[model samples]
Target: MAKAGNGNWFARHKVITAVAATVLFFGVIGAVSDGEPDTGDEAASADQDWQPDAENDDQSDEAEPAVAEEPTPEETEEPSDRDKTPKSPEPDVEREYLVVHIVDGDTLELGNGETVRLVGIDTPEVGECGFEESASRLRELVGGQAVTLGESDEDRDQYDRLLRYVDIGAMDAGYRLIRDGLATARYDSRDGYGRHPREDAYIAADRRSADITCAPPPEPKNFADTGGGGNCDPSYSPCVPLYPPDLDCADTGPVTVHGSDPHGLDADGDGQACGGD
Candidate 1:
């Protein structure tokens, strides 16, 4: 009976040893399979919880890029220097007339096929210095606007520049253009076309040109110390009162002065205001 009990104990010990060995083998296989450091099942549970977040990051990286923001109007840069100055006034003319074509500075072909010369302004002619710039500026001022032809006493000149008063309403593009130094305010007889309400405003701007420091001043007057011996016409002469700066007696033509209530020298034979000289 004692021998039988010993055999049974030996068999039970062998069975227990086999079970321990099997558990150790499985633990080692799980740790070594991924070649990752092990902190037991607790670390594995933490990593499994983070798996969904990793998948979300991968999806975000595959999404399309964001669109860039557009620049604001003030932030936008002008394409060129020409854009810095507006060419024409906004269209607000009471009368409607189509521009047939541009002849040169201060001149335009009308829809009625009339060649209208803009009055009270002289622009650089083609082939003259800065002519192209002046033409470009003129185009900008009248290119797409409605125009009206205000007739003058001298409808046509020797040069065929039709003298007329131009308006784009209160916004006087002519005056604005001259004030900005893009044109010269030239005068003519009011007997035909009369004065524009903005004429004085233009004159004021023209007067400031004398103050422009860039250009050279006019030649010294030839008048003696007595101040009145010249044989030139007093109406056109700069030695007399009211002549424009830098203009000589020879330069005076048939230009009329607008907005001055008092009578001045006459250039044309007509008794109207600003008729001559």
Candidate 2:
């Protein structure tokens, strides 16, 4: 009976050991599966965080480019020197007239056979103090040259000559004559004739010329007593000697007299000493 009881006790002890070993194996397997899932989750989180950083770096490199500004209106519209120059006076009507003849310092004959009296000034008459000089200067200014005519208040004078202002290039012929002391500024207050835009300036020039003194011509003498042939005699009735063959108004027919015309040849006191009647 004692041997049988001992065998039974040994079998029971072996069964208990086998059950403990089974429980330990299952616990180890469960632990390994849970650790593997945790490792995978950590790796996925790290990858997500690193992707957002790379995307931020790319976005910073693609920042917008800078733009330029435009200019203002004031900088583009500055005035120039050409804008400061004074403009020439406008005329009512401008006509181009050809100068066929220079009558005197203040008269001209047109190609159309019309006589033009230069308004605003009168030069010395033939045989007068500045007559020859004035006539010579006028020829130099407009003889055989084209001139521009500006009409005044009066179309014609009592002498039947067209009254107009003569422009030679950029200069006014009347003003030039007065400025040079070759002519005197004269205005007809009755008809308002000879008045001009530059009247005041012309009067000033005339005053300046008149201030200078000129020698008086000699007394009249008889041409018959001087043998009718001598130097110019200011005292004579004609104021010129006949013997010296001097150029009078008749002698210089239709010709320009640049030098002294000793005889009072220009009967009409025209600037021309000798011209067509």
Candidate 3:
């Protein structure tokens, strides 16, 4: 007879216990080998995903776009407007003005009773130096002509005159004024004014302008007594003899033309009757 203790129990169930333990060990091993690790923490920590994206590592990357960010209006906004070629200047004059009268070298009175002052130019006033010559030359250039007007940044000046550039056919009247020394370049980029289109050309012409050459004033009335035989025009020393005819320096040889040369003896316009500056 055996001892009726734990030994009896062990011997009776040995095959069953061995089978159960073996099944438990293999099931755990299979689950661990086939089922993957927890990837959430790893994916969160890493720059790249554990499973790479089909198109790009980043959805924002343009390299291989698949399900990427949609393009914006700014994408269309830039290329068309900013990248286009620059434009050329267009013709400005739309209609023409018929010049009826010349107010001065730089001013005009049109047939419609509008007055326009030449933009970017200044000439002598009525009683100032070169006034007669400036006025005369303007008449010769554009009087009674139909001229096209080009506007500046400003349309009118302080005197309520239209500020414009006058053009006859292809000839620029303002440029002619500056080139001939009848007018000087003004109201341009220089001297605190807006610059006009032809400012540079006018300045260049002004540099090459002829020196202003006109006449000197005539003599004092009592500079010398007219007590010779006849009454004398006191514009000169030794009585020029009042003009029955307009005289020239050709008539009088080097007379002292002081106050006013009524006979027009001072061809050179120097202080002496017929001399140079």
CA lDDT of each candidate? 0.61, 0.71, 0.79
Arranged by lDDT, best first? 3, 2, 1
**Each model's TM-score?**
0.37, 0.44, 0.48
The residue-by-residue lDDT of candidate 1 on 29-124, one tens digit each, is 977887975568888898777768778988887895767889999998778987677788788645767775767767777777677777687777
Q: What tens digits encode model 2's per-residue C-alpha lDDT throughout 1-277?
A: 8999999988987998899888888999998887776777799888877767677878876885656667788668776889988899888466678998887889989998999998888887877788778888888888888899877767888899998888876888888888888888887543465456667777878787643235796543433234334454443333345336554444333433333445555555554544433
lDDT of candidate 1 at residue 226, scale 0 to 100: 26
> What shift in Å separates residue 168 of candidate 2 from its native position after superposition?
1.6
The alpha-carbon deviation from the true structure for residue 261 of candidate 1, after best TM-score superposition, in angstroms, is 61
The per-residue C-alpha lDDT of model 3 at residue 156 equals: 89
Instruction: Check candidate 2 and list the clashing pairs.
Output: 103-272, 104-271, 219-235, 220-235, 221-235, 228-243, 229-243, 249-265, 254-275
Best by TM-score: 3
Please report how far candidate 3 places residue 47 from its true position, in Å. Answer: 36
Candidate 1 or 2, higher lDDT? 2
TM-score of model 1 vs. true structure: 0.37
| Candidate 3 Cα lDDT to native | 0.79
